[model samples]
Target: MRILQKYLKGGISSHRYKQYIICSLLALFMVGGVCGEYFTNCSSLQPGQYLCTEVNIDPRTQQPRGCTKEGWAKVLCTSAPGIICTETNNGTFEREIPCKYTNGYSYETALLLSVFLGMFGVDRIYLGYYAVGLAKFCTLGFLFLGQLIDIILIATQTVGPADGSHYVISYYGAGIEVIRMDNMTYRMPQEDWGVVGRGIKEL
Candidate 1:
């Protein structure tokens, strides 16, 4: 309290006061950055719980489609039909594969930040693109053109977290549907391989 009073009362030199303020702001920024990295609570989900990967939106109504009216689509784990599987707490059978992990980054947050602060490069910095952030900052978001481009990219989810993590959006929110490919969904064409081998033998 005494030190703060001294600074406030102008007991410290102006140069020292400015330095102190700058240092304080920098410290706060660093702490905020660290806290922001872990803003999501996806880790709290249990084994039986599921995460919504995508929400399909209707073109005409601009609302979510399928599943519940709130767009709560239950993710199902699939495997070979005959394979034994343990029933989850939700009364559904799921394979051993775990749900996708999230790193606390949010799609809505990124898009909003890009729309509002892209000119200052805050969006790129928040997404962990230090180099691009610095460039944007120096160029004023490339004279604002880069800012506009970033807005589109973020809205479409073309740019994501630096660690290659997916954005954590609300299950009820509108999002583009993504088809997930798994071992059961994909298989090598044995007939095609056999035909190629026969052709090689004839040659």
Candidate 2:
């Protein structure tokens, strides 16, 4: 009874510390599962590799699975076992690629274009919103109010590809198994951090 009391009052572990640790880890995992987004670039990946964005940094090593960040805007990604790297003219290379998609239509791309050319409706046209692009172009982004709205939308991710497909930012590594998302707003299918797959949206 005294041991029980101590456990309840947090006075002693009574071998319960392991259980406490496990519960804490479970809670952390749950939180991590819900907050699923990570920022990365896909332009650095080889012609066919997709970006794997879901890799979590290990708390102990401060490293992600098969990935290392060498500098700002530079990530070195290593593939898992059984996949082979090849010699290339540029350097050593591996070429397990995913289905190609337009990299220029991604969220980051849209944000960039919107920042520079939204007033001219270039961003809208880029995302395949041709009619709206025309209107925005003629009206000068609805006198710039519409441009402001688009900026907010793209930043928030409430917008998506003009094809109405959802964009899912997932990590794709050479020789790694692919995980597909359904009913998403956009799909950024590459893994190199410099390139992105689709358009931006509000929220």
Best by lDDT: 1
Q: Where's the lowest-lDDT run of ten residues in candidate 1?
A: 35-44
User: 25-115, model 2: which lDDT tens digit per residue?
Assistant: 7788766654332222333444334434334443332333333222122233443322333432222233222222322345557888888
Model 2 CA deviation exceeding 4 Å by range: 1-104, 166-203
Per-model lDDT:
0.65, 0.57
Candidate 2, lDDT over the whole model: 0.57
Write one digit per residue (lDDT tens) for candidate 1, span 1-203: 66578888989887887798888887897666642222222323354444343445434333333333233433444322222233432323422222223466778789998999999899999999999999999999999999999999999888888876556665455655556788769866567888889999999
- By TM-score, how accurate is candidate 1? 0.43
Q: What TM-score, computed on C-alpha atoms, does each candidate reach? A: 0.43, 0.34
